[model samples]
Target: MGMAVVTLKKGEGRLLKSGGMWIFDNEIDTVMGNFENGDIVLVHDFDGYPMGRGFINTNSKITVRLMTRDENVDINEELLEKRVRDAWEYRKKVVDTGCCRLIFAEADFLPGIVVDKFSDVLVVQSLALGIDRFKETIVKLLRKVLAEDGITIRGVYERSDVKVRKQEGMEMVKGFIGPEFPTLVQIEENGVKYEVDVKDGQKTGFFLDQKYNRLAIQKLCKNAKVLDCFTHTGSFALNAGIAGAASVTGVDASQLAVDQATANATLNGLSDNVKFICEDVFELLPELEEKGEKFDVVILDPPAFTKSRNSIKNAVKGYREINLRAMKLVKDGGFLATCSCSHFMDYELFTKTIGQAAKNVHKRLRQVEYRTQAPDHPILWAADESYYLKFYIFQVCNDR
Candidate 1:
């Protein structure tokens, strides 16, 4: 049988027409010819106008993820190699080559595949059916591309253990891609060192997207007493210590995370000034407030409060509460570096949540700077998911 052809319902390819990479099941008018799921198929408008070719999965709500918009382009080894090469070249220009996100799913034109480089190790999370089929090929191509730059990846670890994999009918899995090497790898960013645990850590072991954001915090931390909440591996806290902060306190609910963060602090010779506390930030914040604790800089880098729209109300409450409590802990004229890592929390809503928090605390915020994830995770204009992280620096003015 010839390749299956998908015809869009009359006026249903609006997203595809607008350069978006998704074709929902409801958008299709008909599936002509015989094809297996995950097979590459041609896309056409209801009037037979060629749209492009993509992989279709009846199991996914995203029925089709466009691979190539060019009718002449073929999804062959040559095309895949070029895509991987282009992604690597882009990272070299936009981020630190030592550690960065090489391919960011749809943003890099490779839908649903994320590859992060940590020192000479690569960690991958393949999140979609179409990309899953090509995952091994992409990994091989990525290694080949990096080898050209004198970067020999020692090992690759798969961390596709997230529940989202189930949505695509994939089994959650984690293991070494090939011969196992020590899962722990060391790398330096902005003059600070870290031991990233690629085998088992949050979201591919390290948050390379915040490389510059941590650096940005350094300039404001000199001689300041700092508090870094949700300090996973103490990245920001260590940065504060390296910047000559008087003292830095890093808090997390996970003892494992706190231990790792503490070890990372020692790795950077920052142990003298940086301390990690294993405690729920929600509970710790109230106790600190009760103690009349104050810090010259309070950094709130919490995990995503909500990943779905249904929990947005609860997420907003979480954001507002932590930010308000954090505001009270900041000394007058001190700084607040806050951020949200949930795409569901849009910029407008997040900013408004913070504004309401400040208002609730009767505090005036003197804005300093607004930022987002590093350029390594380039945000595509039409793919809003790439733009999830929102960061803001402000002077918390409590003139009570």
Candidate 2:
């Protein structure tokens, strides 16, 4: 195969030298030759020496996502297979639970792709132009890796509804890739059981990234009155109930999510202590406060408020608004669990937003735990930008 080398201008190689995987279009000085999207090309420095091997996409803002910095190595099926196998090996060694993020995007050195393994099924999402173009190869690699491990995967479902895909000029597509669709599957994590819908529900049927956070809240739930706002499928509320909360109330704008949450609660035989409301959280919180409702714990895990840089300011307001309301509702000293999946909002800004909210409510907070997407949604060290999920568990305090 003919080789195409991409050269970077002075100082543009800093991110690469620092082990970062992405190279934006503006960072490159020249592309020696034309290469198809997802084509692995040799990267050269300003001095024209081979620097690395990476996937290319001229049409993307991110022109390159490097797979390796080793000059002697060639990027091929063998290398790809090795990466997948290595990811599996790491998961096996650390994550004993069947429910976990199986393949993280850049952390696995495969940018723009995510794979979540639940029971016997695998849910994959491709958000980059290069990865979307090479999805067939990725699918084949997944199957081959599972087969080699003597594991028969029941299905491979696609959940590529991410907004990033649109920027890559790809439309949202989802469904079963195998012979049959899985309407529901039972998964156990941290000794808690869950039934996830991989076909038509949230990311691969469940937010497996919150596995640990859910379990953490479980330990604090005994005899506590819990309120789970934006309670999609009631992962937090149900976990609270099952973990021995005196009672749990869940609220969401989606009746579908409410229905599913109710069904999940019943599945675990915790319906007696759990209640669901299909109401917009923005309006419901104040009503609950007026009704003299107080909870020992409250969870606020909303969808991404900022999809791009343009929406960040408004998104911060949204985040701060929800947090301020939730913090007020929690009894003094009660736990407040809040999260943001917006990549455009960094942790510092997110915390600052929370701080502003706390000030607005005239309340103080003590952060107890800081969390991110689950281990399977690996944050590649060089690619902190891809690790967008953030969570903070705090204890509400009285104003001085």
Candidate 3:
């Protein structure tokens, strides 16, 4: 049989034309020829102009994810190898390769799959059906590509156990892709060591995106009283402790996370200065405020408050409340580092909310620096979803 062809509706494909990878179901006028879901298909404009090639999955609203704009290039093992090599090469140039995001799905032009390297272990998350079929191939290719640099991959694990996989018509599953090794992998970033649990830890076992953001706070922490809210595994708190913070208090709602974070602190021999407390930040912040507690440096690294647009209003409220409280907690002329990981909470909105919070709390913020996710998670311009994290550092001052 000939290749299946997907024709875009008139005036559709705007996002695709601008270099995005997704083609929504509503954008496609029709599909001609025969092919199964997850099969490679040819894409065409409304007037039958050849557009590109992509994998189509009717199971997803994102019907097609373009692999290439060139209609002539064949999608084969050679192309896959090239994609893997290019991603690895880019990381080698831009960020530390020891433990970083190797492939960031659409940002890397691979679409629908993310691979994180923790030390020698590789954790893969395949979120789309079309990419699910090629996960093993990509992993093998990545292993081969890394071996070229004399880097041996000890093990590979799958962490595709996300609810979004159900939307893609795939069962959520995770397990060792190859011979099982120890799940807890040790990695060092900016002189801070972490034991990443690739098998059961959150989101491929760690948040590698904040690799540099955590480093940015080091200088401001020396001999400073530091408070790290939502300190999962004590990444930021430990960094502060390492930077010679006078004292560090890290809080998280999860006992598991607090235990892990406490273990990490002990692992670094920072248990004396850096401590983990199991408490809801929302509750603890107010309680600490009531007791007139203050810190020279306050870090707010909460999880995504809003995952989708529908709940953005509530997310804003959550962000504003925590930021206001954090500002109150920071001593005069001290630093506050706040961030939002929700893509729905765009930069403009997040900044506006922070400003509002500062005004309400009678605090003045002197902008220090603005940062995003580490370069390893490159933000592809047209793919807005690739750019989720927004971090800001500011010196909080009481109004004169």
Predicted candidate 3 versus true structure: per-residue lDDT over 1-400, tens digit per residue: 8899999999999999998999999999999999999999999999999999999999999999999898999988899899999999999999999999999999988999999999999999999988888899999999899999999999999999999999889999999998989999999999999898998888899999999999999999999999999999899999999999999999999999999999999889999999999999999999999999999999999999998899999999999999999999999999999999999999999999999999999999999999999999999999999999999999999998
Distance (Å) between predicted and true CA of 352, model 3?
0.6
Which runs of model 3 end up more than 4 angstroms from their true locations? none
- Candidate 2 lDDT by residue in tens digits, 1-400: 5767899997787777888888888989988876777787889988887788888877678888887888678766787788888888888876653777767878887778888888888888988876676676777787788788787788788889776676666788887666776568887666556678887887667888787788778877899999998989888988898889999999999998999889888888988999999999999888888898888999998998887899888999899999999988989899899999888889899999999999999889998999987776777676777678899999998796
lDDT (Cα, tens digit) per residue for candidate 1, span 54-167: 998888889999998987798988999999999998988888888899999989999989999898999999988888889899999998988887888899999999998887
**What local lDDT score does residue 192 receive in model 2, on the 0 to 100 scale?**
53
- Tell me the spans in candidate 1 whose CA falls farther than 4 Å from its real position: none
Clash count for each candidate, listed in order shown: 0, 0, 0
lDDT of each: 0.92, 0.83, 0.95
Instruction: Tell me each candidate's TM-score.
Output: 0.98, 0.94, 0.99
Among these predictions, the greatest lDDT belongs to 3
Single out the weakest 10-residue window by summed lDDT for candidate 3. 127-136
Q: State, as a TM-score between 0 and 1, how close model 3 is to the true structure.
A: 0.99
- Superposition error at 120 for model 3 (Å): 0.5
